[model samples]
Target: MNRPTVVRTRDELRNVLAPARRAGRTIGLVPTMGALHDGHLSLLRAARQRCDVVVMSLFVNPMQFGPQEDFASYPRDEERDVALAGQVGVDVVYAPDAAHVYPPDFATFVEVGGGLTDVLCGDPGRRGPSHFRGVTTVVAKLFNAVEPDVAFFGQKDAQQAIVIQRMVRDLEFNIEIVVLPTVREPDGLAMSSRNAYLSPDDRVRARALNQALTKVLEVAKAGETSTERALAEARAVLAEAGIEPEYLEARDAENLTPVTRFGPRPVLVAVAARVGRARLIDNVVVDATPANEPMAASVDTTGGAPCVGRC
Candidate 1:
């Protein structure tokens, strides 16, 4: 197996990717917090298919984790991550240290203001805007360092993907943001690095997140457009599995605003729950229209089908 050349600093990344830039070859970036899984590799495969040079960043960004969050316990295995990237034909693995990513007196941050940072995972009582601030900042730094033509993200992080897309547009990053489908285990649980923390029982309970989202899709397809009504069905699914979600909400997928009813624009039904030591999240984008009107986007009703994956 061919191993990707791993670089540990911004200068090394720039020096490495400069040739591709000079040669006018398109470079695609897959920014990750290491702990490569099928969900992450799916993005890598897409990048390999679309770009001449595929750069995957393996930095486990400290800034994104809240004080009580599992930054310390979050998984990291550079050797295995590099092997996985190599398997997908990833050209470069930029795995920088925390000090390098956030140097001393590092005061700058990138934030997407307005309501996008005010709801769901961004709620002030939860991870809040600080989480996304950390995310956008690191992403901006990566954009500057790699200067790739495109960036890949998974739809499982529905809000993060949306927020990053906004940041890209507002900041004029000159990179294409491609949101791919969420990958899941055969049991319907969305694949996440945090899944590593799940105990066996927690692993089974974690399936509720996807099951809940699937319930929302079912209700919407049945002409139940009321966000409250659909979410009620979703909550029941969580309740059945004895999994109380931190937040289960339906919002306008495009702007992340509260949606009273699913309309022409897609509605994002998302859930975040704590299962044992793992904080798992899952979402399905609902494109249900009234029975009288045609559906807005093609959707898959299969139990574990991802929201954006089918849409």
Candidate 2:
């Protein structure tokens, strides 16, 4: 087993991986805060298979957190994460401190304007207005620092993936954004670091997030064309499970845009709900048209056009 090398600062990371980058090695990056899990390991495996070298970034980005968000209490288990990264075949781990990444007088942020940020992650009441801005800014910094040929993100963060994809295109980062399927627990709950905050009952109720999306998929498969009806079924499932649904809708599976009517394009039935203090989200894609239908064709949510994909 090749133990993964840990690089704590930008200078150390560059010094360690500079040779590989110069040799034209295709590097893949999986960025996450510490506290590694099976879902994150799945991403590392995917990166290992596709790229010559894999770099996993373990930085708990404070910029992405809102004032009321749990930035202080966000989980951190560096030793465990480092051990898991080695087990999962990560070549190098970039673990940088907050002060190192962001200086005291740091200014400038990446903001995806034109209503993109305003839709999903934007602060409706200017509450989290800087959320996506922080995300894009840090991601941009990571891209520059690691200089990976490709980056991997999880589908569980549908909006973040969409926003990052758009950012890459707009900024011309020359990096491929590969999104992996959402890994879930056996009970269908999407895996998330935040799950640690859930109580036992809340953890059980969290499964409703996936269950609701599954119900929507069933309805769509049953020839139900009414998006409202499909969403209603999902809402009922969540309600029965004692989860307060924040949003339940079918949308373009690629851009995270809401779709009023289903067509031949693939639609994503997505749900987000709060089970106690944990906010859980899940989604399933459904074919808008039957296989026998003439116009039926698979949709690529991650490809072409913006605002067409949903989570």
Best by lDDT: 1
**Candidate 1 lDDT (Cα, 0 to 1):** 0.82
Candidate 1 collision pairs:
none
Model 1 TM-score on a 0 to 1 scale: 0.93
Candidate 2 residue-wise lDDT, 154-202, digit = tens: 7777777778999999999999998877777778777778789899988
Q: Identify the runs in model 2 with alpha carbons over 4 angstroms from their true place.
A: 123-127, 289-311
How do the residues 1-311 of candidate 1 rate in per-residue lDDT, one tens digit apiece? 57998999989989998888899999998898878788888888999999999999988788888899887887878899899999999999998988988879999989898799878998998887888888889889999989999999888888888888999999988999888777778788887888888999888888888888877777777778699998998899899989988999889988988889988787888888888988888787887544533332323222111111100
TM, every model? 0.93, 0.90
The positional error of residue 165 in candidate 2, measured at the CA in angstroms, is: 0.7
Residue range with the least summed lDDT across 10 consecutive positions in model 2: 302-311
lDDT score of residue 91 within candidate 1 = 95
Candidate 1 regions with alpha-carbon error over 4 angstroms:
289-311
Model 1 weakest 10-residue run by lDDT: 302-311
RMSD of each candidate?
3.7, 4.5
Clashes (candidate 2): 9
Report the lDDT of model 1 for residue 24.
97
